[model samples]
Target chain A: MSQELKQTPLHALHAELGAKFVPFAGYDMPVQYPAGILKEHIQTRAGAGLFDVSHMGQVRLTAPGADAALERLVPGDIAALSPGEMRYTMFTNDRGGVLDDLMVTRRAGDIFMVVNAGCKTEDLVLLRAALGDAHVEYDEDRALLALQGPGAAAALARHAPGIAGLGFMKAATVAIGGTEAWVSRSGYTGEDGFEISLPGDAAEAVARLLLGEPEVAAVGLGARDSLRLEAGLCLYGNDLTPDITPIEAGLTWTISKRRREAGGFRGDAIIKAQIADGPSRRRVGIKPAGRAPARAHTAVVGPDGAVVGEITSGGFGPSVDGPVAMGYVTRGCAKAGTEIELDIRGKRHAAAVVKLPFTPHRYAK
Target chain B: MSDVRFTKDHEWVRLEGDTATIGISEYAQEQLGDVVFIELPTVGADVEAGGDAAVVESVKAASEVYSPVSGRIIEVNDDLEATPGLVNESAEDEGWFWRMELSDPDELEELMTAKDYKAFLEGLD
Candidate 1:
């Protein structure tokens, strides 16, 4: 029997907007609205796009030493995180592979974390087993929304004043639609945006309020995936997996200087060694030769016609007006401008290694 | 107007004498959203009835367009290579995927007529 799919708090609203639903992370989530993925993607780059990301897991950990306790799990310098600061890090396993990537925010009295929907159950189990005294509170009562693009701030500022002042990677409690919500100036789309975590009961009201803005259109997972792909952001299961390490994924930067020197997190030794003598393979941005997209699982071919790597995330980038993809390749072939061949369905297509963020990041600094 | 027949896979065949013009239905294109790329079977390629003959790719996913009747491809849509979105704009007319010489005209009898196809679509909802 097929498993019953879950619905987000904004499901009714999405249906009202004529969103096409698809199964993702066990949820019947909207993949695109009537405007379609291409238009939604371009709209997010040009104007404001509102997204219902409530399927993502949200939790709050409270303890006297929550920051230090959290540091023992991930390589990020959570202990140094001041209140209202958010850091992106991954849960590394003993073998140095990434279990999942998550966002850790230092709230006033606790650490607020948002994990991938597919990994939430496993993450909670791991966190509960590892965090001895820290109280892990699953905030299922809340919903997450992302307002992104060039015009996002202007549209959001009308609802919550002073939100535009919060710098990138910063978080603050703001009143949105007359309800308290945690607003963070960070997003996966590489656009100027804010992620608002609010009460589930108030989600629909605030969503409608945001959609009421002329600049804000409802964007779905289809555009969300394309937007993040263009931004070069890694999706949890695709670009990252149990077999991929932060070092191999080119996410070592998330391992801060202090965290690198202290070396106490899980798989620290393996990660340290990989950092010292670069990883065998690294994730790099790929641009195919022509209009035909090289999708995920497409083999990366070397000069000798040997399979060297495989595309993890890929599709037609509406904004780029061409095919953009990301994949893991031997370190030697990971450099920008390196010529590679993508074998799509028994045919080889010419491609090149390029710097990430296929489109320039337009974060609000 | 020539008699148009549709297959369960959403491909449409417009029969005229010994040749038939094939393309996906407008409903199929609307369901697939914006078409980005399409790969058509080469001319002179023999395709079996109800077999894959073309691929239509949208920004979201790729779908195979099946041949409605056994035939040898006489003409393939080359314009789709540069302007695949034409399929979304005119799926039944200018967006025809190919023209084929019917190997067995009796195969057309197995397909659904326009009225039956319309009822089939309604039943799907």
Candidate 2:
């Protein structure tokens, strides 16, 4: 095993809390705390849970015409994104395939972006190589922490007043516990929450303060996976790979009407055709019949025992009280009520296509 | 009740005349985390020693529970249907998975005694 795993700003804190540390996205992250996965999942749903996501990359794109330069990569209407608002968008390859899905926010000062931890290095290299001279800055010394659940709003209000009034998808530069932070009302868990981006030096102090609260607990990567799976969010390597297109990932709404009409982004020609004519395969949600959870790479079988599709993500959803899965199926079989079978270890398990997320999102409007 | 024996794969068998009770060892349940599902063999089904006889799924991973000694499955612990966590809570006692009639009493020689199994566990770490 390679002992050269990357460390987060709160690596010591995780160890102090007796967390089961594991390597994730190049960083040595906590897989679970002593509270266990079940308790952590329930705690995040009921109260507030803090997560250290400092490994995710933060970059700014600045050029003579940055909007036009940035539009060359993604299909979303980036120029139209208002100040203090964040948009979820994807970067595409030349073949209309999604390289990665990321959050882009136009700050009062600059055009800030947050990409997946695993793809951040590649994204930076690609962005810089594509722009040539477009002054792009990678803020590698910044740390991100998410305070999520129903109690998140109240928790933020105590430290940073007026943040409670911020609506979903809104971003504001605020001082959290006297530390300068960019607090955005965005999360991957499909819950009401805020992600605080602060200086790496000040991250430990803020995380420690949050952990002192009775309503707040430190959650780990294990519960994070389960929560995002229940929310129908896409994991970069699994759901949004180089071979999968945004259209097939069931993320058509992220593409704006203006961008759809005037194609200027990379792979626009293929993506536009996919939006109009539909992709060969479509992502669909699956509900398994038995307790056996359909895991990733499980083959999807058609009526006559022929392989039709493959599961990208699947697990026992803690909130759904049963097993749920997401996979790519033939276009016609992506309907919400279509019947399918998942071959788990040669046994075909009955399943039905359903609309994600497996659990309803409770974002604050 | 006859003396119990264990396998390196973490299976335990307690012999009672021709019938024997089988379950996963306490250490196996702990390593698997929380038990989510238990797929038991049907009663009266014949199974071979060291053969795959059951499936045990935890929240983290899935494992196969092999028959320590060949036998005919007499009965399954149906409580696992509604309460799979019982295996985690009581791996060696009330959570016994199945009872079976021994196919060959001599096959029990392949299993390790409790004292020997404890020494094996220490060597593993």
Q: C-alpha displacement of B17 in model 2, angstroms?
A: 3.7
Instruction: Return the lDDT, model 1, position A158.
Output: 94
Largest TM-score belongs to which candidate?
Answer: 1
* Candidate number with greatest lDDT: 1
Q: Which stretches of candidate 1 lie over 4 Å from their true place?
A: none
Q: Judging by DockQ against the true structure, name the best candidate.
A: 1
Q: Which lDDT tens digits does candidate 1 get at residues B63-122? A: 888899998999988998988889988999899999999999999999999999999999
| Interface RMSD per candidate | 0.9, 1.5
Give a tens-digit lDDT track for model 2, residues B20-102: 99999999986776677888998999999999999997655578999999989999999998888899889998888999998
**Model 2, A15-109: lDDT tens per residue?**
99988887888789988887777678778899988988898998887765676788889988889988898999999998888888899988766
Candidate 2 — which pairs collide? none
Report residue A120 deviation for candidate 2 (angstroms): 2.1
True interface contacts reproduced by each model, as a fraction? 0.50, 0.14
